[model samples]
Target: MNLFNDAQSRSDSFTLDTAIISTRVYLVLLCISTGILISYTALTPHMSTIIIKNPPKKTYENLLKEYQSTLECPCSKIAILYGSFVSLSPVYHQVCSSPFISDEWIISSQGKSFTTKDSKAIQSFFIILKVYCSLTEKTVSDAWNIFSQSVLITSHTISNDELTIRTTDSLNQFESKTATEFKRISSLIQSYVATMFSILESNVQFAPYQSVNNNSSVNFKLMPTTQGNNCSCALNNECLQIITYPGVTIYDIGVIYTVPT
Candidate 1:
């Protein structure tokens, strides 16, 4: 009887020991798994944070690239809708109330009402007036360009007096007897003397901010030029060209230095 009792106690103790060993092994495995999970979580790359390492913006060429890139519309993007609205809508307020300033800087103007007495004269007048607006815009653009080169030395802030002087100088040069000078100055400047005032109207201000200035000249090798970028020499049109990066393509715009009527 004693021997049987002792055997029973020994069997019970052995079972308990086995369970304890099994539990210890399971606990060790669990600890190792938890450590691995923690290490992996700490080491894994955080995709949410990103850094774009572009060079500093310190030069005119770099600033020009950034400015052109940011210009969502040189004039306004609403022109397409405005034109469609003008064509389709019976609502004059919805349509013609806001006129389109073309990408080419041509504005739909409200000219004098046509007179029945002079149909051909009226038609010619309309054409002339349209041409005048374009010439006016080009004049402003030229002043901006001239002033931009000047701004490289002077303040980015353009003064009214400075604009006036530039305009006078431009106009005087235009009146000069040299045909090439006149043509060049005219191509370089605007038509309405007032555009000299207006293009400088509340625009043309830029200062280098460490926040957004990327001073690297556009890698023309990486992003090569197309025939369209040479539109300034070709014809007076807005040239939009594509620039390809790794995964995406971007567009940069070009302008014709002159507007021919």
Candidate 2:
């Protein structure tokens, strides 16, 4: 009976030792697993963030190869006005701004014996000239306003080379069309003025010049070549000639003369 009790006690002791060993092994394995999980969680987000932030930048050549003509860059200014990109400035005839068309000049010229009929004609001529200058500027401005409305830039986002080419083409077209229209209007004005004044009559003089200082009457010669300094009025009807008035005061007058064809 004593031997059996001792054997039972030894068996219980061995079982307790085995249970303790099994529990320790399980705890060690759990600690290793927890450490691996924590490491994975900490490193994953950092690695992913680095990848996202430091993406490789593409070169122009690389982008061109990938996207070809389909690639377009955004413009800084999306809706720019036509006036911002293109401007129209009309250079009017110099005669319109000269002193010859002034009230003082007209009043001074009125004292001549033959000035009654000639003065009226000259006044009419100057009035028409001034009107033409003003109207031309207004008309061109109106035309530009209308043209700007119609100018649809479909390329809000476009390739650099293509944008440049399109802009150049548009500018060229506008200039060419505007110049042609201006020339046409000028020809019409010239024709109307000539017809009204009977400029073709041989004996009828349009502008008679009497020198104030010399008291000499100078006949106005018909100029075969309407322009000087290698410039032709035929090419640009707005061509100006500088006329110096050497009398009481030396006045350098810039004048534009339109001869009827």
Candidate 3:
């Protein structure tokens, strides 16, 4: 009976050992599965962040290229920058400088009314003359002289609201004597505008001019033709007339220039 008891005890001990080994194996498998799940979760978001930040190189380059092209024209952008806030009258009419000045320089004028007529005319002429003279082969003084004489003509009128202005060469007369001068002037204007705006992306040499004595050449600020506005150009052909309303006029403003010796 003692021998039979000993064999039963050995069999029980063997079953207990087997259960402990099985429990250890299950614990090891659980640990491995948990580690893999944790690693996958951590890595996924990091990979997503990298993709979002870098994107495709080509996409970034194309966007930059588009942005630069939009600013290629300077005059148009400038016109918009200095826009007027006038409720423009249908009576607004003037010689279109678009053919000589690029379309980019043309902007919707603001604050259009009879009250601001003279200011508008002076502003318009200043803009056109500045751009035009910068591009011409002629010196600023000579160009201004030629422009006043050949292109712009202003006459006094009896009406307060109306002034007289006429262009020597109409839009259709590209071959006329005045039109030829306009064409030559335009070539320089385009070059200067492009250079000033860095469109050429190169160094530019500007045309030179001699200093004029105040006595020899008169400096003028354009004056708007309003009621009782006594401003007049002594020599009609030597000044520019800009339009404020359909028939209104003003001349290259006269000013006293103090020449440096």
Candidate 4:
């Protein structure tokens, strides 16, 4: 009687398990069927109440008009707006072309001569700029990365938002080496570029006229020339005195010079 009772209990447990499994299966099928019915109802166009939430036609038209007006607004004002929306306006022309407005400045051979005895810092910067101008836009970017690292060998200069040259970590020799090396390679690469572009068109520009004389003429000479005395009256010896460059490099002097026309 004990063995028979044990077997009967096992049979009851098995029956309960099977019932649970069947109920789960049935529930799953019911959900699937309900989803199918919903899908079918959704596709039926005549039963519009289910799918077409009747957004009022007038409201829709007004919204469409609003969108059209937004698109029609001047692209100049809306596009590329990070404090220079009007700078690139097609209606007006730029003082200098877009290519000339790069972070780098192109100092030509003629312009460079003006700073022959100039600061090493300014001269080095111009060398980098001249290098940039020689290459394609893509190439210029590649060169800038390299030159940026090297320019800091002297010291990183900060002229506000205008320019800020940086070097890698000074604490680690590895970083310093990398920064210096990057600049050296970048300079070599861009030197070829600057030379190539020099043959095409002279994009280099001199510094703005530092001295305008009484007659409205610019004086580019470091010293007062005999020519200025006879020409329209402008500038004196004070404006053309010998500038002192002590701790500064050759390039810094040049940066401060007025480019000759």
lDDT of each: 0.39, 0.57, 0.38, 0.41
Give the higher-lDDT candidate: 2 or 4.
2
lDDT per residue for candidate 1 within 109-143, as digits (tens), equals 22323233222233333344455456545555554
Who wins the lDDT comparison?
2
Model 4 residue 43 CA deviation (Å) reads 99
**Alpha-carbon TM-score of each model against the true structure:** 0.19, 0.45, 0.17, 0.17
- Cα deviation at 66, candidate 4, in Å, is 76
Error of 2 at 200 (Å): 11
Q: Assess the local accuracy of residue 26 in candidate 2 as a C-alpha lDDT between 0 and 100.
A: 78
Tell me the tens digit of each residue's lDDT in model 4 across 28-144.
Answer: 898999999999999976622222234355644554465443322112222221222111112212313333324444443324433434433344434544444443343434534
Which residue window of length 10 is worst by lDDT in model 1? 86-95
- Tens-place lDDT per residue, model 3, 1-261, is 122344445579775566666767878898999999999998884422112244344654554355443322112122211012112122211222322233433342333332343443433444555454454423333434433343222331111122121222321242254446767666666455434323221122233344469567644543322222442232221223334343333443243222110
Off by over 4 Å in 2: 1-81, 102-120, 199-261
Off by over 4 Å in 4: 1-100, 103-170, 201-261
Clashes of each: 6, 0, 18, 17
Cα error, candidate 4, residue 39 (Å): 99
Question: For residues 22-128, could you state the per-residue lDDT of candidate 2 as single tens digits?
Answer: 76787889899999999989888442211122223355445556657555544445665666666666676666676656767656645534334344455455567
